[model samples]
Target: MYKPRINNKFHKHQIMMEDPCLAEFIPETRLFTNNNLIDLLNKYKKVIVKPSRGSLGKGIVVITELGTEEYELLQLNKQKHINGLENVYKYLKKLENFNIPNIVQYYIPLAKVYDRPMDLRYIAQRTEQDWTITGKYARVAKVGYALTNFEHGSSILTVEDALKSSTIKNFNIKELNEKLNMVTLSITTCLSRYFPNHKIWGCDLCVDEKGSIWIIEVNSSPQIKGFLELESLLPMYQSIVGYKTLNKKKGRRSR
Candidate 1:
């Protein structure tokens, strides 16, 4: 039975990095240190600084290199243009949530639809037997915003619509689903070995313009409200509800 949700992003990243199959899907991530922040930025040019235990996109800052000695530190839609490394640290430390433990990661250049970035939420759940890919949807960022969580959504589209309309011009939908399913299952199975009680994960993932899939993060306690919004997912939502019930009943008997 699910006991408590896992909310530490860095810890989860370390756990998943142990599996060879899941490593490539994960972006370069590390605990936020002044050195790590600078190193990742220098290597990736564009990096994301986020709270280790944040959600709904709060406390996430996307830093992009605009030119020599010029950087853009974006939080929500407000962009702060800066001119030096000293000022970069100053600007970030001024944010209200600056004290929270944070992580720095190489930001994946996600595929965009209509000039707004988008990513897919892949949900996998388990039963008495094995994990299954149960729900998926494309979350488009609000125009001019960097974060695309439900709180910052422009609209939710079927994965098909997102892939075809976005900059990715070529894909066989059958082949794409197969790859997504295989990767998602591998992730859930690998995670289950460490977090035995968790039975569901909502992973935020994206495909770059080059068509490589990257796992943004794995959510241990994924919500179903977004799945409820899509009519086609009603049955899947019901099954999730049923699974939670079964877990609760089984937990009672064990206790």
Candidate 2:
């Protein structure tokens, strides 16, 4: 029986790891061993441990400062923890023993919309000679969830709505768009230098209290599900690939 091979989800991360600047966009990650976990908690006093290749917001935990002595631990899709360090470590160790490949990321206090965390997902594509913004959507974390992934029952809204909401005070929609576009272009341009042929990309970014944008993650194969008028997107993708093929043929003939 022939079996289908699994695609490595970390392939994109490996590529990003090759470039120092790109790697900085990735979260601070480490294997979940006892020593590593202890060190993480001690250094940051608050950290998040998640699956390395996880998606959809499963198996995530948020650690926050309660006081000098106490800590709060909240599990993704679960109740909050207001307990001591001993209990928290026990709970996390149990999760670690479950054979899940986990990493601890420095928790970024994201800007909020409606008392909920908000993040930007920018869809980007490369044309024959230029990289362009295809679309951008804001992912808002559902009540009581740590991450703003759709699988965790989060809601999706346009970037426009997020900026206009009262929760996002001091928000400027036009300026946000400009900043997001600039970051997307910068990331795509840097990646293109290494993989000149790769064209499509999706970037996850977060804005902190000071309105500075920080890249959270990068996705190579972006899901176009729920995008409006995807029929319009098909032609753009066709033209990009079509032009590349035509150029390759012309080069061969000239040679």
Candidate 3:
């Protein structure tokens, strides 16, 4: 059996930064280190440290500035309060497995619904001629959880429903929807330029309270069933089949 994948955060970030359009949306990310952590904390005041190759939001740490010489670190459902930068670095190092490389990302204050952080997932797939967005939905984190992943008990919401339920005031629904579509397509196009073999992607994105959008990650071989049901995915299924059929025909003609 053959497999295709891109799980390295550094490699993916480097590829994305090459596209000028995407570089702005991606938050500052760096390899985890004692100095990097302290410097990032002093600059952004809050940063997230996570393993480079991890899924379902595992082993992620959210560090926040509490006050002078005091910081709070949140992992999964637990929070640890520590004082001073040296202590913070030592604590994180002891908790992490040194064998696995880790990355630190600027934590975006994502929009929320009912006080719980929420994000969106957009699916794009290759059509006969080009790529098109299939569908999108909002994922709200369970109360007190740090991640909005399905495995973490997140609740799925329609775009309209999420806006309606949120405390955000004076928001333009149409404008938000248009922005999401444009960004999702742009991301699909840019990534496809480098990795042409993959035809489908599950893009994890988020919007801040100021309506600024960010591309959190792009998942190849995403878990489609999270939002796509058997009936809803028929068109996508057909599109993939059509693409493969054309490729097979072309291969035979060349031989």
lDDT of 2 by residue, 1-255 (tens): 222112222444455555665565555556666667767777777788766565555677888867765777787656565566667767776774336566666687788887888887877776555887767777788997768876666677777776666254465768877877887887887767656766667788877665666777676666545243245445544544565476567668978
Candidate 3: which stretches are off by over 4 Å? Answer: 1-5, 96-98, 228-255
Q: Count the backbone clashes (under 3 Å) in each candidate.
A: 0, 0, 0
lDDT of 1 at 210: 82
Total clashes in model 1, counting residue pairs 3 or more apart in sequence or in different chains: 0
Models sorted by TM-score, best on top: 1, 3, 2
How well is each residue in 105-156 modelled by candidate 1, as lDDT tens digits?
A: 9999889998989999888877777787777888889988987887766578
**Model 2 residue 183 lDDT score:** 73
Task: Judging by TM-score against the true structure, name the best candidate.
Answer: 1
Better of 2 and 3 by lDDT: 3
What TM-score fits each model?
A: 0.93, 0.72, 0.85
TM-score attained by model 2: 0.72
Q: Write the per-residue lDDT of candidate 3 for residues 1-255, one digit (tens) a residue.
A: 223247676667777777887888899889899889988988999999988777788888899998999999988778899999899888888874545888888999888998999888888877665887866778898999878888888888776787777755576888978888988888888888778866777889888887788988888766655554334545655555565577567658978
